[model samples]
Target: MSTVHIKPVPVTPAEVIAVARESARVAIDPEAREAMARSRAFIDDIEREGRPVYGVSTGFGALANTFVAPERRAELQHALIRSHAAGVGDPMPKEVVRAMMLLRLRSLALGRSGVRPEVADALAALLNADVTPWVPRHGSLGASGDLAPLAHCAMVLLGEGWVLADDGSRSEAAPVLDAAGLSPITLSSKEGLALINGTDGMLGMLLLAVADLRHLLVMADVCAALSNEAMLGSDRPFQPELHEIRPQPGQALSAANIHLMLQDSEVMDSHRNDLAHAVQDAYSMRCAPQVAGAARDVLAYAETTAARELLSVVDNPVVLADGRVESTGNFHGAPLGYAADFLAIAAADVGSISERRVDRLLDVTRNRGLPAFLSPDPGVNSGLMIAQYTAAGVVAENRRLAAPASVDSVPTSGMQEDHVSMGWAAGCKLRTVLDNLGTLLAVELLSSVQGLQLRQPLIPSPAARAAIAAVAPIAGKPGPDQFLAPVIEQVRHLVQGPALRAEIEAAVGPLR
Candidate 1:
């Protein structure tokens, strides 16, 4: 298990993914510990002076004006955690919970949250012990951080709430903490606010989505190239000169990848100069780079937003280097909200265009020389006709999901937080959109491989041949229609995993 060291600076997206998805150990840096101690001294000084701070001495949200005596401050902090851990619905995936914990720990390590070093260490301990808090799917509005979700995680540090072990068995948190040789720490001044106030959940989802989409976008190009070959379509539109004139970086990259994938192809060579067959292919084949490239541009913009958010200090009443703890609106999740929504839209379009190609490959009129639905025998065998329908259904659902969760906001906290971010909802739905996209691309791969096999004697390019070989075991040569749902699932696994990309890259250097 690799370990990710957390410093006061921005952690990389790769580090977050490793810790979130790979059970990577997390270690706080010595510098970060020193920084946390320094930040804690300022809070201690304020406490000793009896100077009221927003979250330390006074109340939160709509109750900000209410002052709490020093004697009741501990109870105030405890109540905050208990009240905010109000999430409902099914528990979130273990990976998402781990990511949220890691990000919150990073925020504390940055020394802006005015938390004791022990608080941060407790989080690291839970992560190293593989004890994940059971955070529910609903309850976060994505404003003022992922309050309910983070509160559930904070509850684990207090020996309250439920947790999951490495084997995924659910149990009470206190026993798990004891077995792991960990002790729950009592919250101090502003610690509860620090724990729950940040955009970690939404930001973690955004970083994970960015990583997944980067790979899927390249795979989209691979699928588009294979579909083009299977349909005997022209590669003229993908010429470097054609894209160079327009000069959209992502567009040019997609065009170059498709052009490279089509190289050394007997199928393409057979139709190199056959103008009589057709002047050009449909938009699904000819304009793939344009659509896919636009998606790449959206992804790039989202990546930039996520990178900036990773470096931000998102807590209210952040401890300043000037020795003042001032409240700020950095916890608002609008930026991450927009990024998640934008990526959802981009992913939907990528799936949409891939579905179009799948449709064309199954249509006898559009499939060039292939039989209806890529069937071995038309009419008698329904073939992959239902498979296209499945892809279409997923695409429709994705379209509905792409309807921007960030755009809708309801006031909360007695209207003190009037205009919530809904960023968490955006991240959640974006996940579903990406999952559907994998299936949509899988359908395209399944149909294209069948069409290529039908074009037998004339082989595809080396990269295409490598792709066909990768999916062969999961989906054999097309024949009488059999159990297609299982085959689609198998192909989806191939599409989502690293093996298919590895095989293709092994044959053709690397793709952009």
Candidate 2:
């Protein structure tokens, strides 16, 4: 993987995804190092003058009014990190941890966190070495900038916490650093506060969610097209002129994609002039573009918010270019919280509609001439009966997870940090919703491909054919059901992976 050079400018979502999911190495730009050094001087001046700054010379949160003696200030920094590292739950995924590390490094490199150049360099070194700290899944209220989760990451910088090896076993940070030819750094003044005081954890997850949702949204369109063909639904609703009149960008894009995918389809062409077909199909078939397109628009809105946040310096007591160390509320995670929650709601609806399409494809009466559950021997073999149940189960779970986490906040730090954002919780739930959405789409693909196979003499469009061919090995022809769970999982992998998209795009050009 190529190195993702960190500069003072905002980092892109792609860079975050590359570093997080692809294990890309990171390096600090020279200009960013210079900026960090310049900012460090301001903190040093405040320290020398004995001025009482929020995190520089005084305590934090509820203890902000407390003063620390000069001699014990270093101990105060260490104590802050140790006490705040109170996260509890299963360890976060390695990708999330890595993304958090990269995002923190980006914030530091922006030269606003009042840390020494070496502090930023240490974070970059950790990323380059692929040494991820073991951050917990819980303990962040999303206000005060993901305190506990970031504190766990900061502990690794001090060589005081646990780090995960390549194989995922944990070891002491000191030994890991030693093996990696790195040493722990002593914290001075605001360095510890700077390290842990940011919304990096929530932002990292949001960016990752954005990247994944982008792909899944396109796949949503693809699956809708496949399901439409399988159920012999009309393509008239997806006409360019029909969507052009509405002019919702996402809706137009979705309509265009479905319209193009159904071009030259024998199944669709077979019924193009049939007078007996229903004047309008069910909402799941006729309004796929509206539902999936609205989800696309929501994802775009989240992306816009994420882009603005990528340029943000989300820390308390940020150092200013005018030589003042000021305390600010930039660390509040409300924006990220709202974005994650909104995306979750949209994703859940998309999954819900996809499951509806799966049901339509499985029903004997509704699936036109297809078998019940698409089984060759309907009663003897339970073709995909349980698969619809699985999709329905996941859709219900997605709906439950879609309840906005941002609206529920609990005060902490003795009410000093009240009205927390809970953005991290929102991001966590969005991840699950997206994962479930992928599974729901996979189930639809499984049933739709079987439906299309049963429509044998009348071929699906080239793009649908390409999609069916891609999953044919794993999801074989419409026959007696074999072990179904493994096949659904394998198809889910294909849905989430790039190969299926590549094949479809190859046949019908790119989807929105």
Candidate 3:
């Protein structure tokens, strides 16, 4: 196997996902290290020269006017981390915590934050060693750069908070530091503020969401193909010339994916007889690409926005090479806030259509002679009847979460944090949508797979067959009214699996 070299040039959501899945270690580029070193030297010089600098000589938030006594500088740094570590609720998942560490390392690697190389190295070591800080799931207003959650992360670096170690044990950072033969990071100059003030917390969740959503979209196409065969729907909508008239990249790609998955299927050919009876398929089957395609466009937009953000230097009071410390709003998360909301909406749409296709497969009249509820015993089993309800409920919740987080801003920090983005909410909601979407699509997959089995002796597309095979080990065909929760969970895991997702993407190509 060839090795893939990941440069620290600019990380995208897809790249972040790839790194997370591949378990690749991250390191700062040499030039970026030099840049950071230069900025740190400049910050030291600024303090020595008795120059006034924001968040360095002066206080933070509502107290920006207060000057810090030289002797109290260390106290100021420690206080910053201790006070901001106010996040509460359940701990974030270990994978998410690791992603946050990676994003933070990358941003600091940009060299504008004036953080020490040791600080970046510590974060990198945490990721490389799989030592993840136990960050909470709530308490961020998206102003001051996810201050609460990020402070929890910074606390771990200071060997003061809890962390999940590689041995799958939760340990206090101080003890872990002793065990690992490491020391806590001491805050100097702008270091503590730099470590705590960034968009990494929100961006980490968004990056993971984007990765999972990409797979969901791909599986959605395969499910659509299976439903198309079961419904005996005309493939006219996917004709390249048909979409070329409008020429949406997403539409065109969706068309190609469906066409590929349905190619050479006898069931699709039999659908030609029905095409003469019906002019077009119902919106669910014929318009699958259009609906799923629009979401593809949205995914592209979200990915672009995240890529730009992960590459940005997001700490406050950026230190420059010329000994200038400019206090600005680089840490604000408005861009990612809107992008997360957009991603939530887009991912929810994928689930919405998947549920619709489930409806199409379950409706016997609409399903073209398939048994009711997709079971051997229709009245007795009630097969898949409530599955649709669960799928619908999840889709509804996603719709509720799609509301724009960037639009609602609450003031905090004595109104010094006024006009907040609440981006952490957006990122968290995006992940929720992803998780819910997995189940929703799993229902669709179960329904579509059963429908295809009813058409046995008539094959599905190669891509669809691979997906069915991947799911079979985890979720077999519905035999009775057995408990579906386990089956559904397994299906969700399969849907999120790398091989299954890659096959679907290879068949479908880039989501528009």
Candidate 4:
């Protein structure tokens, strides 16, 4: 239960992952209070002086032309929250909600959002209390922030929405606030706008996707190595000297990892000097690093995008240090949208390549001397034949999901938001891509493990053996496949889980 302290600066994507996955407690830096106080004072001054600031003394979006009275400003803020909390779907996973809240707190703490310091503190308190607001999965267009999704979060702070308890039950925010020894503060001028107008939801999901892809990519290399050995594919292409000339960091790293995984193998030694050996392995086996490495490079770009976003203040009409409120397009989710779409493409390509390797292992002509579908009885037992079909289906879905969501836009709010990012949609789709990648790799793990077993006594490298051990508990040893669906699911679980990567890294000296 370590605390992640939030200062008036950008947090790293790694920190976001820690909060999302580890449930890390959050603390606001004391210095940020000054900025928060100044923003509040600025908002108060402008409101008292009858200044026509958007979302403060004026209506939102298409109604920005209309002026709001001082007496109704509070009610205006209340109504804005009520109207914008329009998300409709299953509640977002708790981790995503917590990450969104943490990011919003950091943004407000920057003193750029013109919100009270309590708004930031209350956010941290809710996260620390583990009372995650039930944010819906849809309704955001990724313009004017993640509006609909974030507004659901804002609703809880006003005690007008639902809170998901730590135990997974949904309860009214009012009682949840009471049980947490807290009370919801009434919204101040522009506070509702401040809460909902950010890219936290999409950005948080992007950060999580980045972390997941990193692990899955490394695990992908392990799959390639196992496939290479099982298919008796040569490792010469993975030699350091071959990749060194090109100097692509991710490519070189993947090559080096595969080389390590294929080392010290009796299977390789058996065919090392054979004169009749195939001149080259299939592209799926030989060009694994190239395909997987290309994906890795794209992930590097996505990381850069996530890093830039994690520390941004994505609100409309951000209040500056000189106490001036200026409207800006910072709330547009275009940058995050592009990043998310790119990651989806990369995930699909990598998963598609791994699926190819699985097919190679199941094909008698390509699998060297292994039985068809790695089945002991061939036609008598279906073995992992359908598993390849499952992987193919997932890969196809990923391909469809890879179409960039950022490029599509529809007008909303009386055409005030004419070009929406659809970044939220991109995030949602990338999550599905990542998940399919895991299942796709699990199919490879299942088939490749069987291939390694069928190779008999020609032990794979220590790295491959360690990886096998990590996955064997769930993937199990070769036998008449019992309920292949559950086995694939379990293997998919282990692929997404830490066990396989941990053991392989422990043996192969980290798959970086």
Candidate 5:
């Protein structure tokens, strides 16, 4: 139970995820009131002239050039939502919907989309009230601004689409809106275009991925410390001077984090002998800083793109302060779409490296003196062998998903949308990578903890010891193959958390 208050001020995607995850309420910033006033004034001016405006007086897409009868303008808005609600495949998770809603509200909060104030208010209310729309996961090229999926969202605004109501049950959007005493929004001028155009889907994916990446960064340090202890590898490679010469922010951060996690440990110091194992550690161990550092770098790039998107006004026929209507490419999603694919690739690497470590920890040959599969009985039980296999399978799946969706495009509306970012696919796959990465790291954490237990007499680094202690409540050493699933499930719970990492650091003092 938490509350994130957004005071109409612009917020980062990370902040938006925090608010959505916590079920927080949002209010318009008083500062933005001025912008809203100016935008509405421009809209009013356009209405008074009543001449011609794209999406206002005419049709959409293939019919953009056609003149729409004034009497059917409102009908056009509703029809646009219905016709575009072409999403298919599995419904998105409720959390994703919550995230989408938060981002949509944030985008509208910028007050540059020229949306009716009530529409934004309705979105915020849905978020605060926990009324999430049931959005399908597919059917968006991420061009034409996430049209299909967003239409599902907009449909709810018009008292249509499927929704999760107050009772936590699915219901028709119209009945739910009726129950909530809210009326559907009537399309005013370019309002229909404003509702569906933009990169919110991609924004949601990056927001979720960034949050996951932050946790993985901390877990990476913990995993490295554990692997270092388990394999008796030297911590000298993580020295500050080594990273200082290169002066990469992520490298320094990784070195510092690993240093902190391994500080003051008997196991770490014992392994400084530089025992000749292939003259150097495996790439997974030797190159932890490089690999994890690259991920951090990519995440930074994704964050920049996401921030710009959240603050952008992405819609057609953008209203100008002087009442000039301009149809522009503000709705282009290529930037975010590419960022999404790139970030997913980076995140997939996190899982790949983690799975490699898991494999090393399991194999008796490469695992130094640890028992085969970390099992007390080598022949009778094949402990943790299959865990590594599962990890490998997930890693391979993530690699497949990491292929950039932004590189592919298909034409639509007679080539009006010939080039698309496929942004929704990018966001969707990135989210999948986030889930896979979480599970991958969880397995590694579980294996590392079990391996550490095998070295009972010799203690790990102070920070590593603290992390083990925190997760110990959730996971215990496997007695046999009996219900290893329960132990694996705990990996998901403890490793992907800042609180657990903080607790470990508190006990260990500062990581290097």
Candidate 6:
């Protein structure tokens, strides 16, 4: 297995994916271990001196007014994690739970959480051994961290929760921990609180969403190129100089991508001097770069936020270099919540444009004279008529899902957390929107590929031709509409990932 050394540095989405998927193992940095020792010593001092440290001597939440004696401190932490593991609904996906665990480990390894180095080691061991905790999907308020979900994750470290084995067997966490050659760790002072406090869950989902949408946005640009070429739309709008006037980096990049991918096309050159050709294409055909590019700009902001969060130690009563521990409100998830919601809005709009392009490609009135629906038998066969309906349905759902979850909040923790980020909710909705967008892009790509094929003896650009060829096995050439549901599903699976992108890039170099 590839081993990832865990330190107090910011991590990349790729690293998170590698460890979360178990393609990589984790190791503790020696310096981090030493730092944890020192932080733990500071906590020890507070306890020995009998000062009512927040999580150490005092009870939690509004119950902070209550104090516990030294003898019951260990029980206090166990009770804390057990009580907080109160989430409901189906379990989160294994990868999301794994990513949360890995991120929480990164935060604790910073040595500011006052956790014993052994706690970090146990978490690393659990991840490396592929013992995934079955974290519940709901109940996080996103204010005092992702308390419910993270608590479920933290429970597996203490051998009190359910574990899903790599072989798909489910068992009690204690036996699974033993099988992995690990034992439950007793929580030290402040350890339980640290384990659950952070914006890591929402941040982890946001990080994954950013990585995914980056690829999908590129795919959207490629699909847009195909749609424009099929519509015989002018490429003059994609002129580099024209984009330079506006100077949006994302817009410029998208225009450059279309400019390069559609270069040297026989079909495009054929209509260059045809005065009969329409002066300009519809906005969906002409304004693709602006729409897709603006989404790219939003993604850039999300990436910046994710990078800063990766390096941050987000917890209350964080340990300082001078050996002081002070409670702070760094656990608020507003930054991640806003980023997730914004990306959802962008993804939904991208899907909206792609859906419109699908409609234009299938309509006889708007399709610029391809066979109606590109059907070989025309009126006799229904062709891809219903496919547009499916795309429209998904796009409409995405529009609804795009409504910002961050703007809504509900009181919890006895009104102590009256305002919440709802970032977890936002992250969940964004994932659904992104998945729907991929399906919508797949439909657009299948429709465009058919339109290009029907244009036939009229050759397209080398990149467009190669994409048609690459997807032929899945989308096939237009004929009497044959069982389109399976074909659409096959095409959706291919376009949802890097295969078609690989073919396009091979002919046109890097798209970015």
Model 2, residue 9: distance off in Å is: 1.5
lDDT by residue for model 6 (193-268), tens:
9899998899889888898899999999989999989888889999999999999999999999988877888878
Q: How does candidate 5 fare on TM-score?
A: 0.93
What's the true lDDT of residue 413 in model 1? 79
lDDT of 1 by residue, 1-512 (tens): 49999888878888899999999999999999989999999999999999988999999999999999999988999999999999998788888898888899999999888898999999999999888998889999988889999999999999999896556556898998999899989998889989999999999899989999999999999999999999999988999999989989899999999999999999989978876668978999999999999999999999999999988999988999977999998988999999999999999999999999999999998888899999879898988899999999999999999999988999987999999889999999999999999999999999999889889899889988998898878888888778888999999989899999888999997999
Off by over 4 Å in 2: 166-168
Better of 1 and 5 by lDDT: 1
| Model 5 lowest lDDT segment of ten | 1-10
Q: List the residue pairs that clash in candidate 2.
A: none
Alpha-carbon local distance difference test for all models: 0.92, 0.90, 0.79, 0.88, 0.76, 0.87
Tell me how far candidate 1 lies from the true structure as C-alpha RMSD in angstroms: 1.1
Candidate 5 segments exceeding 4 Å error: 1-9, 29-34, 165-169, 274-279, 510-512
**Mind giving the per-residue lDDT tens digits that candidate 3 earns over 301-382?**
8878877886687889887656678888978888889888888887888788889989989988888878998886898789
Q: 1 or 4: which has the higher TM-score?
A: 1
Supply candidate 5's per-residue lDDT for 36.
Answer: 56
Candidate 3 lDDT for residue 505: 55
The C-alpha RMSD in Å for every predicted model, in order, reads 1.1, 1.0, 2.6, 1.4, 2.4, 1.5
Candidate 4 has what TM-score?
A: 0.97
Query: RMSD to the native, candidate 6?
Result: 1.5
Which whole-number lDDT from 0 to 100 does residue 25 have in model 3?
A: 69
